[model samples]
Target: MGRNTRKRRTPLATKAIAASAALALGGGGLIWANFYASAHESNSGQNQTKAAAGQVATISCPDVGQKLTNVPQRARRAVAKELANLDKQITEAYARLASTRQAQTRDANFVQNSIVGPLKEKRAASLDRIRLDIQRVGGRVNTSGLGSLAPCTTQPADQTNAGGGQNGNGGQQQGGDQQNGDGQQQGGGDQQQGGDAGQNIGGQAGNGPVAADFVDITKVAANVQGKPQNGGQASTGSFTTKCGVNANKNHNTDNVIVAPGVTNGAHHLHDYVGNQKVDAFATNDSLIQDQTSCQNQGDLSAYYWPVVRVQDGTQDFDQNADGGGKEGNVGKILTPVQAEIKYVGNPQSKVVAMPQFLRIITGDAKTTTNGLANANAHWSCTGFEDKVQLTEQYPICPQGSNVVRTFAFQSCWDGQNIDSANHRTHVAFADPASGACGNGFKAIPQLTMRLVYEITPPTLENGQVKNAYAVDGFPEQLHKPATDHDDFIAVFKNNLANKIANCINAGKQCQ
Candidate 1:
């Protein structure tokens, strides 16, 4: 976390075509252009780029969880625990990648031999245990190819995934040493001290949230379009719940829904607004018995998301902690000014009451490497809501306006399971055109959450970002905006749940 903690790094000299301009002028405001950052030669950076052909920014491993779709229910807990271990392995490898910048510049093979190789071996061991657990429970799973996911490759800064995921529009990457945009772009970084101009505007821990990761909202054209609708009997009402925006500073780095039983599973700090007892160890029974932050005691749902930080030199309480600065996630955590939690009706059918303890995760936590497949976070500034909503680029708002993040969760359920092995698959989105649920899926009241924050906008003049802000992420993810995500657990009382269904079905909005 020190500026000169290791001197093997030369300044990151970045050259990017102004992705912001090309994106704005391209289509009817909805045209999303990819932001590609390529490493090039410059007097200050040429020697360093040769170390690994580019600074070995982070490690990219195939997402094993996305592939293990059939682990039996009896084995899910054990499988999830192993999955968390895989994330820990990646975090440890990335930490080595960041700390050994000097050694990397000396021997090009150091990374593969010293870091990646050991990582693959460790992952192979965990994967073997996972396969055994599934087999023990009579679940059909891969016994051979599963080990292939163990080998992780290093990703250069320029090749980071930045664009092309559905939110309200596209804003963030793919690979190629070739140039692809039309204008010039720069990035932001924080000097480990007073948070002024540092090495590059890449970030606080010297990884990312680069200039291309953000765009001026005023430059983006209007792109807010409604979902397709077909005439049919519809439930048009909504139910709103009042959960204060985590004023008590209920923060942690745990994710019970995904990596239960593992501490620091998230590898980044998260802000919680409801269901005070939720943590990496919380069980469904414990959740039902926990306290609530909602105004209505009947609602004890758990809602949480990654914390955003302003990289201006100040340190957080967890600066030296595991999921904090030690893992490359440093800086001050900003609390939201407003957290709007609402449930709305389906346009094509009456929504059934969601079963208590149902779990839903919207957006991909590792979208920077996972591709745009599960990316679903929408970012925009207050007054410019109708102009643009971004998935990759964080919106830079004008004075008086704060940042807004919206998550519209899946609205169709598989009718049986409350959860699945992947924490997905059991829930899904209705048809965007007709609002029809998939076969065997039942329409469920959709939850839409909007979070607002007020951090002074970072300056992006003279090719450097001062006071950059970014969401906390796994060390390897490098704080990319495309990685923003959210989680929810239904804990409503049975009577209250029925009332919600009744209200929505009757087309009556309720609070």
Candidate 2:
């Protein structure tokens, strides 16, 4: 065997050495490229701090065997695909992170403002989970310990288009290969549907009173100022009719003109100039007092005559204005000296169905040493002799049954606050005025009336009532006839009452 054996070819050895040398060079180059890429992308300046971190240089190598050598191309393609997937995941994570940050900021602001509660805490926890996911991905990138030339058996497939623009084998896969596609599609569809639904929701809003300048007189009667020839005493009451097309089912309210009568039976027996009384009576019988009777319509205080604000379809205000500003945004009240009532519907003099009963409480009475110093009396009059139904001035909502909720009303004298050393004393209108003993009388009847109109649940916001008044009427720009009192009151009362009722139903107690 020794005689037959020949020395191994030096040329073969040389070729083997060359191949090994080439492999070493390629491996070193690849590792260098990988490390360079990582360093360049590192947030902590990995290139500059590599020595401090005790990290070795990196190089990439492919299998040498023919069967395995085809791996570089496969590996390159896989790395590209994995990188693309990672990019997509990172993008989604970043978006989620941004949302979480925004939520956190809002929660922080809420907590600062003392608005944070259990709901806010739960939201914070959800955001924290998203943040933790971001941190976890970051940790993997920073703490991985694979060598530069190490071959990753589980390397994700590459999805890149190389020079030939060819994708890897089985790269044309579809369907389940795409992750979260179904979820994203569904989410997008739901978002669009929700937006469409929101667009369909309707609301009622106005810059100011809906019908401010409109007015109408649906009825009228002659006033002789004194006892009639038939011995029928002169009175301050009128009948009315209203008509309208309720297109939107909005609320409405109305008010009527008032004529004052004497507290005594005689037309002009005693006259008072401020605090002093006059002696003689006027024989012309042309004298008329400006007063009101039938105060406190049920639970409500009183409905104002000249100008009254009806809210949510149930309550009436003695004053021309309500507490809140135009849209009822602020909880502020301002009492106005005067107001103008505008009829809501029926611009033409069209007669509508009128209320059946008409009741008038005339302010007339006599006073004696009966200890009723600030007390006044009223006479309930029904069925006027003149059945004339001319439209100009008439009682709109006569004989309407109602209810009221009474409680202590303490308003700031200066409208600033309920408490302050400079603030004025709080007056309880329910109680008799202080110092009422010696100076004739110190108490005045402060009770008022607010009208209520019965309505169904569907009529209101899903049918809820918290306030005594309802307000309904025409739009703000419409012009109404000058003779429609009934229409105006009906609209205003319905609108105002509904608002109060809704507020009450929502757990806000009446004041």
- Which tens-of-lDDT digit does each residue in 1-511 have in candidate 1? 0011001111110112233445543532432222222121222221111111346666899999987777788998899999999998888777666656667777989999999999989999999999899989887766778878888887765566753212224321110000010000111122221122112214656555555566777766555544546347787778889999998999899999899888888888899877999899999889888899998889989999999988776678887788887776777888999988888888788889999889998778897777656766577888876556676778889999989887778888888888887777888766644667766788898888888899788765323355768898887786778788889999987488888888988889798
Model 2: lDDT to the true structure: 0.18
* Model 2: per-residue Cα lDDT over 282-360, one tens digit each: 2112111211121212211122211123323221221122211111111111122211111111111111221111111
Model 2 worst lDDT run, 10 consecutive residues: 174-183
Candidate 1 structure, TM-score to reference: 0.85
Model 1 alpha-carbon miss at residue 284, Å: 1.3
lDDT of each: 0.70, 0.18
Model 1 CA RMSD to the hidden true structure, in angstroms: 9.9
Give me the runs in candidate 1 sitting further than 4 Å from their true place: 1-53, 163-201
CA lDDT for candidate 1:
0.70
